[model samples]
Target: MNKKRLLAAAMSVLVAGSMLLAGCGQKDVKQAGSKPEGAAYKFRLAESNPAEHPVTLGDKKFAELVKERSNGRITIDVFSGAQLGEEKAVLEQVQLGAIEFTRVSASPLGEFNKQMSVFSLPYLFDSEEHMWKFLKGEMGEKMLNDLQPSRMKGLAYYTGGARSFYSVKPLTGIDSLKGLKIRVMQNKINMDMVAALGGSATPMPAGEIFSALQTGVIDGAENNYPTFVAQNHYQSAKHYILDAHQRIPEVLLISKVIWDKLSPEDQKLIKQAALDSVDYQRDIWAKTEKEAEAKVRDAGVTITEVKDLKPWQAAVKPVIDKYSADFKEALDGIDKARK
Candidate 1:
């Protein structure tokens, strides 16, 4: 009986030792982005423009980079053409964490973060180069960070090219815009800008702009060249005035709720990917802008370039001066960037 007991005890000890050794040999996988090993995460990105648009393409590139860097651990699905919602509605969804990501015009964001309205000021940047320099610098970082309080985090800025007025009638100069009803974004700064320029402001969503112009609900609207072509606004509003008034950028944002849940490493990785995609977007945007200009001209659309902008600048100076106090820091930073 004693011999049998000794043999049984020895067998149990060997089995226990083998189990411990097996565990030691196993690799440890740290949880990333609150996800477990072999588990993948999927996110949705909201883009109001069509798939072919530069901003949408940029978002896709960002997703591609993230998926490649994460080795299939993370994937993002982009819903273009406002499949998720219009700009404002999508932004609200992002803030509530109902959606994961979105790329929206910085103009509309003024409703959420007052500082964002600074971008809407007429002639804020001396040139596209000046605008990009400011957007990629420290002040830009602060402006992006300012969205945190609104329950969203700004990821990166995409080029909006230059915003200009296009109308059913010829927009020859500041005098041409007088008394015309201009469609503007749903923000006070844009409304005020239209008002300051001596035009009646009609606030509406992007999707509604084409019909509004066709039905004579609005006389004109202001946006980048790419938007004018992509949205087919040039079909109805045949006159484009190249005043290059505002170069408001489009901003990518993630829900703060979702951002807080991501691992620090994952957050850093995603931000770097977003920043890298900016170059891709900017390149395509330049090419597209040129193509759009040619297309519009070929379509018999009247193109008016204001060589002397002093008159237009003077006309909108009151709009800028009125809001200067509210955005002193931004204005100061912009001044520094001009140099």
Candidate 2:
């Protein structure tokens, strides 16, 4: 072969190889960006309700927002009514990267991060304004950041409403609660607070509350208005005392597994959507509480609005003191949050 002809053949071979490699690179990029055939990137979200609750509403809204913002690139499937199992089970699944998201009360989270006990403190938040300021401020960010180490990410806070007292008999004042068996969340602060308030605190799952109340296992239970009405505990415990004791906020959480898989742009979208949903849910919750209070009142349940929070606050002071010693740093943060 002539030398020029041989060089031309070699150049053609190199060009063909370069084109093949470029084609493969393009194919890989396409595969990475595009969804697989007949399959969506299903994000499994779980909550402990049947879609009517505020948390479920928030979950549904979050899914809708993600679908809209991602242009259908991401899809969230929510499992409500503990279908994905109890809150603790779901939380463990999230930690192991098996589940995508959940809305959990801070009580169970207290078992994981002791700092969460701060929220369980009775009378910690003075009012709705004080609660919002603390949660949307630096203190809230710090608390949210604290969850990262546990493989959980705090997205936003949902209003669980103010914890109050209800009884089979009328509870006119704090003294009326003396020696009564009051059902409380499975938390030390809650137990102690009820005890200090003159009720014998009984720790039980919320699901068992109605049965407990019905069977005289517990004479009363403390929770927000929505829970009291939704769970139908009002039938048994007709007297609703508006002690407004603890304004504990429910937390919306995402698994770090699903979070880390998100692109930075997608992360920003999800966070913003969650914040907006929080505000939306809070408004809905406030309205719901009003409706619930009115409905329960019409059902012949007496609603007593306690004026003297000082006695309630004074009673639970030892709870604060004990927690302060055990959780000094968190207490310090709460003190700063109040400012």
Candidate 3:
């Protein structure tokens, strides 16, 4: 009986030791990612791009990193393909704190922060490297900080390559675009840019473009390569002119309402995650653009490269002049950014 009692006591002690070791392991994992004594945070990110889009993939990567770095303290849920609503409507929701985040083009974002329209200015970026150098510098930081008053915070920028003209007929030069009715975003800058380039700018909804092109309601529309192929716009419009106009950066925005609620440490974690996602998205953008260009050509679209950009650049001079007053600071940044 004494021997049996001794064995039972030894076994009980060993079990308790193992249980304590297991608890310590859990504590270490929790400490790596947990916020200090707070409830878990869950955020929703809205994206209008398609599910397979690089933007969407980047959004997922951001969420994944946040999860890993936070040690499960915070989780970000992404809603893609405009699952929330249109950009303008969703932006309003973000301001109201009904939504937490969104990925928006600099064009529609102009409605929230007017200076953002500067990104839509034609011929602003000489090359991708030039644009990125500016974006990763103080000027871009100011642009992001500019959103605070509007109750949003700019997190990061992702590329969608450059916009160009696509038509059922060839757009070989500035003269070739004359009298052609081209679809532009429903924005003053975009409209004026197209008009200055000699195309009759018709601002319309993106969804209407395919049928409109088919029925000859409009001559052509302009967008990036992925959009041109994904929407089957290549089926209706065979000529894609690579003028590389308007290389706008897409911005990731967070609701200030939600941001204010986060712990400083958590905010830092999220911001770093967002910045990391930018590189991932850019790589995806390059790959997607190359594949998109190939697919559209396989579908028999004629892709035209602009040999002389001097003529194209000269055409939008009036547009730069017209918005010179309101966006002067932004315009100046563009020139300075080139350096």
Candidate 4:
């Protein structure tokens, strides 16, 4: 077989095996009912973010909400900071019902669902509101439900905020990125986005970025304000530019193994709790961005906001065109959401 077909076939086998292992038996949706005395099931939810990160806070809120909604019968033990394992490993365990839950950036999720790459594509959404409108709308719902075949059921999406470019030196515009080695998630789309912007894309693990910046292993990296500051990456890469490239949403995923085994009533409650937590998480995120930016400035970081992003957008047009060919329908759905 050719490489593409072989890869697709391998993915199919992997997903199919996972489904059988996870007992993928989804039932028709039922109307929400009052919380029951519930089967006292204790499950695990893993997160890689720091304990104080908004994503972790959202997980805590979801756990709290689930306990309250279930009257404490269904307990979720939340593991923060990769106490379990890295995201890909936790995801594997989750698929096999070894772990019950996880919250992750939609970027890694592209490994499971290629359509998810749309999120990693630069400048896909015009604004944060536009991104949400697409995510919370029909196409978004379809994407969440689509995870079933992968032995994953996406419960809801939380705001991860926009990722921007930060460098050891100041970034003036689209031209500023030329030939700089920028760290990106080890994903093709992300790499392409950086390359399209005229930078050499260096894919590396999140854990290694600080050292990479400090030791000149990389020239800079892109991420949200809080992450840039929290990692003390500011000390190494002092220039912060608000190109706001990718506003990739965070995904809350449950094991289809665990999900299918749940009583439909329990499933409804879990979904409700997760959806409710989205608003709470977004509120925390807004306050956090401001707080992180202020603190970075206080630490003597040069922060630049790109009000006119036309040049930056234009630079990544090829990345957009390439994905558009493969994901035209998906791209159109997002465009529709813009209205």
Q: Each candidate's TM vs. the true structure?
A: 0.89, 0.85, 0.86, 0.88
Measured with C-alpha atoms, the lDDT of residue 30 in candidate 2 is: 46
TM-score of 4: 0.88
Candidate 4: which stretches are off by over 4 Å? Answer: 1-36
Q: Comparing candidate 1 with candidate 4, which one achieves the higher lDDT?
A: 1
Q: Judged by lDDT, which candidate is best? A: 1
Model 3: lDDT of residue 145: 82
What lDDT tens digits, residue by residue, belong to model 4 across residues 70-186?
878677889997887777666777776677899988888888778777899998888999999998888898999999998999999999899999999779887889999999886
Any runs in candidate 3 off by more than 4 Å, and if so which? 1-37
Instruction: Say which candidate scores most in TM-score.
Output: 1
lDDT of each: 0.86, 0.79, 0.82, 0.84
1 or 2, which is superior by TM-score?
A: 1
Could you tell me which residue pairs clash in candidate 2?
A: 49-81
| Model 1, residue 249: C-alpha shift (Å) | 0.9
Local error of candidate 3 at 18, Å?
Answer: 41
Better of 2 and 4 by TM-score: 4
lDDT per residue (tens digit) for residues 1-339 in model 1: 256744554564355335433432433222443443333456789999989988899999999998998887667889999997799877776776667789999989988889998999999999999999999889999998889999999999999899999999987888999999999999988888888889999999999998999999999999987889899999999999999889999998988977886777778878898899999999999999999899999999999989999988898888988989999999999999988
lDDT of 3: 0.82
Note each model's CA RMSD in angstroms.
13.9, 13.7, 14.0, 6.1
Clashes of each: 0, 1, 1, 0
